[model samples]
Target chain A: MRDTYQEQLDELASSLAGMCDDVARAMRNATRSLLDADLQLAEQVISEDMKIDDVRASAEHQAFGLLALQAPVATDLRVVIAAIHGAGDIERMGDLALHVAQAARRRHPQSVVPDEIKPYFTEMGTVGVALAEKAGRVIRSRDLEAAVELEADDDAMDDLHKHMFTVLMDSNWTHGVSAAVDVALLARFYERYADHAVAVARRIVYVVTGQMPGPLAV
Target chain B: MRDTYQEQLDELASSLAGMCDDVARAMRNATRSLLDADLQLAEQVISEDMKIDDVRASAEHQAFGLLALQAPVATDLRVVIAAIHGAGDIERMGDLALHVAQAARRRHPQSVVPDEIKPYFTEMGTVGVALAEKAGRVIRSRDLEAAVELEADDDAMDDLHKHMFTVLMDSNWTHGVSAAVDVALLARFYERYADHAVAVARRIVYVVTGQMPGPLAV
Candidate 1:
């Protein structure tokens, strides 16, 4: 019985890590669709989001069952509860990617990102995917080191977001208000995607250490 | 022992409701600060956000204690679990308000919303506060009727959000790129604040009905 319980817990963690993988793919494809003006890729990201949501529901159900039947205590209890929260965060990351894809679709046939700003988004998207992948590994291994590194990675995403805003607000900006609004919102989506990844990593640190991770040095 | 356990569960619900109240006030003040360019109010909203975070941590601890000690099952278990999720949603609402407050502070002495766009923000702020207050009532009463109403209320927020985008994209827009970016993000903050409120209400419905709420009619 105890072995079964332990296996169930491990399965729950794997399910959440699977969610991170889905979000990573979604973020990458969403960014591609935006830069390439590929409606098909955008649509695919939007549709596949349901798969991520399904995983979230299943993970939550598993965690609920563990709490109800197995009555896991101590670190085991924290792990189950963290899974519940982590699932929600990862699901939200999927939603953020969906928003990015929808933005790409909205401006289809016309690339939403201009040439100069493309590099910023490319970097942001790269950072977003890396963070999501790291979050998945951290979830499976309970690696505090990797989790802490995710925080620094998130800072890089934030810097990219700020740079995007600076570009929008520059006196020489010629993209006009509509493009500015789109860029502002798109940058926000990628930044928020990174934030959720960090949130999932922090949850793992909490589960392992039984304490919230403290602030990282710069 | 059962009586004490029941009381703890009730206390958890109350704590969550109290979080709603804090968020409501924060949203209201944040909006006021933005519309009025009141730096002091904006600072207050920013500082008070910590109080809401404190409530979230305490509520989660309370739920965790109940899960570990009482080992609640079925409806009781759902309530405890829902408290964890609902607390997170409510805390996010508070954070959204904080974002609004920060925006107002960043542009202090210069009103972020121009004359023509003020009406949209005013209505969005009103809607945000109403949703937060209603979410509190739904948490305490578990009123499915009230919970459903929040969905509609959130629709109003979305409409306002869409309209703000339209206004920003309009050919007549003269606010320039910087102001457009501010309005875009501020409108998003209010819309998301309402979204979190709807999320909390849905959690209550799930606790009561043991199922997720269905999509609301347009």
Candidate 2:
């Protein structure tokens, strides 16, 4: 019975890791759609959100079942709890991608952000993809060192977010109120995405090291 | 052994509830100081934040200990997780209050907001205080009904936040760019405080119902 349960748990973890990859792809596609003003791609990201939600629910159910039936302890308990928390984080990331997609739909053919701001969006997209990939790696390997590095990556995203705001405040951009609102909301979505990624990293650190990193360390 | 663990859990819950009260008071005091331009009161709020942080840490440690030692299942496990999430939310709420205090200090004797916008600030303060208070009640009672109603209050806050932005966009309040930045940040702080409060309410619902509320319900 113990061996069977262990096999089922491993299968559940593999399924969840696959879902994380899809979520990361959805985020990258959503960001690309926003930057390139691709309404069809944005709509694709928005419509596929239900699949992310379904996957999250299934992952959560598996985690809960493991906890209830197997009565996992110590490291096993952490793994199950982390899976549950990570699934929620990935779901929220999907919602953020949908937000970007909705913004794309609202702007239609033209990007709300001008050409100059493209680099920041690109950097943010890269960070989002990296964070998602790292989350999967940590889940599979329980790699504490990689998790620690992911925290720094989250901080880099924060710095980029601040830079995005500075650009919004600069006199160079004259898109006026709509542009400002779009930038503010976009910054919010990106910041929140990074925050959730940090949360997943934190859970990984806790699972491996049995301690949460200091805020400044992240 | 079971009885001893249950008693310890009860004690931990009581301590967490007390911590919530302190958090609620801190938020109210901080926002009142901001509205009234009371620098001394603002400083007091800042000073008390460390105490809130300490209590939050203790509550989290106690919850983790309960989970590790007792190996609680179902409702008991939910309560422990809910407490951890709740403490984190309260800590963030305290941080937002401190942000309001810092903004107040920046304004000093003169208010950043014009007289015409005082009504908006007043409404925000009133809503902010009510939200904090409701969080305290929910923490104490674990009342899902009250938690559901609290989301409606947050909707009212969202409406006020939107109105604030519309007012800022109007040419009549022309207080220069710096003041505009200050007002925008102030609006964001209040809006985010309400958001955290809604999160706390959502956690309460999760603890009671064993499922997350739908987006529309929130």
Candidate 3:
């Protein structure tokens, strides 16, 4: 019975890890759509959001079912709880992508984003991908070290977000008020996306170390 | 042994409920400081933030220890997990209050908020207080129905937030780029505070019903 329960838990973990990968892909593609003003890709992200939502629902159901059936204790309970929280974070990540895509669609032809802001978006995308990958690694291997490192990567995204705001405030940009709002919203979305990813990493840490990491300490 | 475990779980729940009450009070006080432009009150919020953080940490630790030691299953496990997530949301609520307090300090003697916007600010404060209060009640009673109502209240906040943006963009408020940015940031903060409150309510729903409410379905 224990072996079967463990196998079921492992299967749930694999499914959740896959969902995280899809969410990360959607985020990256959404960012690309924004920078490139690709409406098709943006629409694709909007459509794919339902799939991410479904995956999140399934993962949540599985976690709860495992807890009920296995009556897991200690470490197993921690893993199940972490999976539930992580699934929520991943679902939100998909929602953020949808937000970006919607914004991209609104700014269609003239892309509110200027050439100079590309690097910030690029860095955000890279950090997002890294965070998602690290979350998957932690889920698979229960690697506390990898989870800690992912938290550190989130700091880099924060720095980049600050820099992006500075750029928005710079007098050089002549796109006017609407553009500024767009950039601010976009920056906020990316920063929040990174925040959720860090939260997932933190959950992983909690699962392995049995304690929540301090914000400043991380 | 089961009785001891149940008693420990009850203690943890009581502690968490107390922490939620403190957080709710902090949120109300912070919004009051913003609406009244009270620097002293704002400073009070800043100082109280530390206490909220400490309470949050202690509550989380207690919950973690309960799970680790008792190894609760089924509904008990769900309750502990919900408490941890609720504590996190409450901590963020305290943080949001700090954000409003900082903004109040930045405004100084001359309130950036014009008299015409007073009604909107009043409404926001009312909604914020209501939401915080509802969160506290949910924590105490585990009342899923009240939580659902709080989720509906968030839609009212969303409408107010949208209205504020519309007002800012209108030709009437000719307050240059800086004022526009300030209003935008302030609106974002209030919207986000409401969002977090809604999240707390949603967790309550999950704890009771074992399902997430559909987004915008409120």
Candidate 4:
């Protein structure tokens, strides 16, 4: 019974790490759909988000079962609770990616991102996916160093988001109000995606150190 | 010992309901700050956000203690876990309010909302605070019917959000790209604030029914 319970706990962690991968892939494809105006890819990302939601539900159920039946204490209890909270954060990351995809689909054949701004968004997507992948590694390994590095990577995403704003607000901006609105919101989606990834890393840090990371940098 | 555990559980519920009030007040002040272009009020909302954060930390600690020390099961277990989740949702609501207040501050003296669009933001704020207060009532009373009503109120907020977009996208829109960006982000903040309140109501429903609410309504 003891061995099986321990296995269940470990399995919960693996499930959450898998969720990170799901959101990462969702974000990568969502970004592609946005930049290339690929309606099919955008639709695929939107439809597949349910898979991520199902993973979260199952993981939370597993964590709740561990807490109720196993009555884990101390570090074990923290792990169970962290899994529940971490799953919520990861599921939200999927939703943000879905929003990005929905933005792509809303504009349809007309690409949402302009040519000059495309590089910044491309970098944001790359950084965003990399953050999600690193968050998965942090969950699986419980490597505190990796968690710290993940927060630093989130700063790069923040920079990209800010740069996007600079390009929008510049007097020379020729994209007009509709395109600017789309770009502002798209920037927010990518920035929020990185924020959730950082939040997931913070949960890992809390589980390992018994302390939540210092308040979010921004 | 059993009686003390029960009291702890009851206190946890009160704490979460209190968190709902905190966020309600924050949103009210944030909206006021935004509408009036009052730097002092905006600063107050921004600085006082820490109070909400501290409330979350303490409530989570209380819930965690009950889970670990009491090993509550059945509805008792759900109450503790839901308190944990509810606190998180309420805290995010506070953060969203802070974001709104910050937008007002950034645009200082110059009102963020043009006179024509002020009515939409005003209604959004009123609806947002009502939802938070309703969420608190749902937490205290476990009234599932009230939770359903809260979801409907969110639809009103959604309509307001949609209306704002229409106004911005209209060909007659003359606010320029910067103002459009500001209005877009501010609208998003209020919409998300209502969404979090809805999430808190859903957590209460889950605690009562032993099931998560259906997927969010867009």
Candidate 5:
């Protein structure tokens, strides 16, 4: 019985890692749709988001089952609890990706990134996906070192977000208000996506360190 | 022993309600600061946000402690777990309130919402605070009827959000890009604040009804 319970805990961790992988895939496709203005790809990313949601639901169900049946104690309990919340963070990351895809779909054929801000968003998309993949690795391994490093990885996205604002505020901002609004919202979606990734890493850190959740991510 | 555990559960619920009250106050003050350009009020709101964070911390700490001490099963376990996530949502709502105030402070003497959008934001602010207050009552009472009503209350904010966007997209939009950006972000802050309030209600319903969280709030 004890071995079975331990196996269930392992299963929960793998399930969470699987959810993170789905989010990473969504982020990649969202950035692709944005960069390429491919409405079809955008739709694919949007439709695939339900898969992530389903994974989250199952992961949570498993976590709750463990809590109820195994009545996990100490570190065991913390892992189950953290996985539940961490899966939630990853699921929301997918939703943010869907929002990014929807943005691409809304202005189909007209890329959300205008000529001037294209490179900035391209870099943000790249960084967002990379960070998400890193988050996935950290989720599965509970690599405390990499988990701690995730915050620094997020700094690139933060810098890009600020740079996007700088471009917006620049007097040379030739993009019309409409484009500016799109970029602003898009930058926020990516920035928030990165923040949630870091939040997931923080959750892992909490589980590993047996500490409370760190300061709320910005 | 059972009585002590029950009292501890009650304490957690009351603590969450306290955090909700604090968030509501922050939303009201944030709106006031934006409309009035009262730097002092904005500063006060910003500084007071930490208090909400502290409340969330203690609330989560209590939840974690209860989980470990009581080893609560089924409904008892769910309540403890939901409180952990619910406190997290409430804390983020406080952060959103701070962002609203920070927007006000960023402009200092100048209000974030321009004259044209003032009425819209005014309506949003009213709706935001009302929903938050309703969220508080729902948290404490777990009033299923009122909880269901909260969704309709959020619809008002959503309409206002869309109306604000229509104004932004109007061809005759005379507000320069800078002002338009400010108004766009401010509108979103209010809209998101309303969404979080409804999310909080959904969480309480989850606890009471044994339902998993409903469809994503946004």
Candidate 6:
């Protein structure tokens, strides 16, 4: 009986890791769709988002099952609880990615990002993709060193977000208000995506060390 | 033992409702502070957010306790899990409120919102405060009628958000990029605050009717 329960616990961990992998793919594809203006790719990312949502739902369903049946306690219990929250953060990250894809789709063929801001978004996309990948590794390996580095990694995204605002605030900014709104919201999408990545990393750290990760590193 | 567990569940419900009250007040005060540019009120909102955070923490702590101790199952287990998610949504609402207060504090004396867009924000603030209060009632009373009204109410906020973009996109927008950024972000804060409230209402509906609320209608 104990062995069966242990296998179920292992199953939960693997499912969570699987969800993280989907999150990584979604972020990468969404960013590519936005930057490359590939409508087919954008459509793919948008459609596949339902799969990501399913992964989230299944993880939560499994969690609820574990709570009801096996009745996990102590650290086992915290892990289930944290899974509920962490799954949400990851799901929201997927939604953020979809928003990026939708933005690209909404402005199809027009290159929603102006020439002046394209490079910055390319950089932000790269960071978002990298962060999601890193989050996957952290979840899969529970690598303390990798988890520790996630916060500092997020700083680069924040700088990009701030730089975006600076560009919008610049006297020479001529992208017009429509483009400015696009730029602002898009930067926020990436910034928030990174925030969730770091949040998930914190949970991994908590599960491993039983100590909560400290303030988000700049 | 069953009666004791039921009482503990009731206590958890009360704590959640209390947290909702704080969320409502924080939204109301944060909007007032931003709209009125009342620095003192803004400061009050910012400082008091810690209390809101504390309430959320206590609620979650109790939930973890219940999960560990009583090992609640089925609907009881779902309620505890939902409370964890609901508390997070409420805490995030508080953070959204804090963001509004910080925006107000950051632009003290000089209104961040320009004259042309003030009416829109005024409307948004009114709608925001009303939604938060309504969310509080929905959580407390689990009033399905009130819950049913939430999505439509959020539509008002979304309309305000879209209208904000329209104003910004106006060819004649005289306000510089700085004001545009402010309007965009402040509008988002209010919009997101409403989203969380609706999310909480959905959880309430789920708890009362054992059916997940669809698309965030109150």
Give the top-scoring candidate (DockQ): 4
Who wins the lDDT comparison?
A: 4
Candidate order by TM-score, decreasing, is: 4, 1, 5, 6, 3, 2
What level of docking quality does candidate 1 show? medium
DockQ of each: 0.63, 0.32, 0.35, 0.79, 0.66, 0.60
lDDT of 2 by residue, B1-218 (tens): 98998887777667666766776677777777777888898899888888878787788778767766777888777777667767777777777778777878778897767667767877887887788788778877888889998889998888998898787677675555545665666777788778878878887788788997886321
**Cα error, candidate 3, residue A175 (Å):** 2.2
Using all chains and alpha carbons, the TM-scores for the candidates as numbered come to 0.98, 0.86, 0.88, 0.99, 0.97, 0.95
Cα error, residue A21 of model 3, in Å, equals: 1.0
**Candidate 1 lDDT over residue span A1-218, tens digit each:** 99999999999999999999999999999999999999999999999988888898889999999999998888999999999999999999999999999998998889998899999999999999999999999999998999989998899999999888878888999989889889999999998889899999999899989998763221
Report fnat, model 6.
Answer: 0.73
Question: Residue A14: error of model 3 in Å?
Answer: 2.1
Clashing residue pairs found in predicted model 1: none
Interface RMSD of 4: 1.1
- In lDDT terms, how accurate is model 1? 0.91
lDDT of each: 0.91, 0.77, 0.78, 0.92, 0.86, 0.83
Candidate 3's residue-wise lDDT over B93-206, tens digit each? 778777777878878776656667768877886787778777777767888789889878988989999898788767676655555665677677777777877888787787
Residue-level lDDT of model 4, residues B1-218, one tens digit each, is 98999899889999889988988999999999999999999999999999999999999999889988889998999999889889999999999999999999999999999988888888999999999999999999999999978989999999999988998899899989999999999999999999989988888898999998888854
Name the runs in model 5 displaced over 4 angstroms: none
Minimum summed lDDT over a 10-residue window in model 1 chain A is located at A209-218
Q: List the residue pairs that clash in candidate 4.
A: none
DockQ-based class of model 2: acceptable
Model 3, backbone clash pairs (residues 3+ apart or across chains), number: 0
- Residues A2-101 of candidate 5 have per-residue lDDT tens digits of 9999899999888888777788889889988998999999999989998888888888889888877877768887788788788878888999999999
Task: Please tell me which predicted candidate would have the highest TM-score against the true structure.
Answer: 4
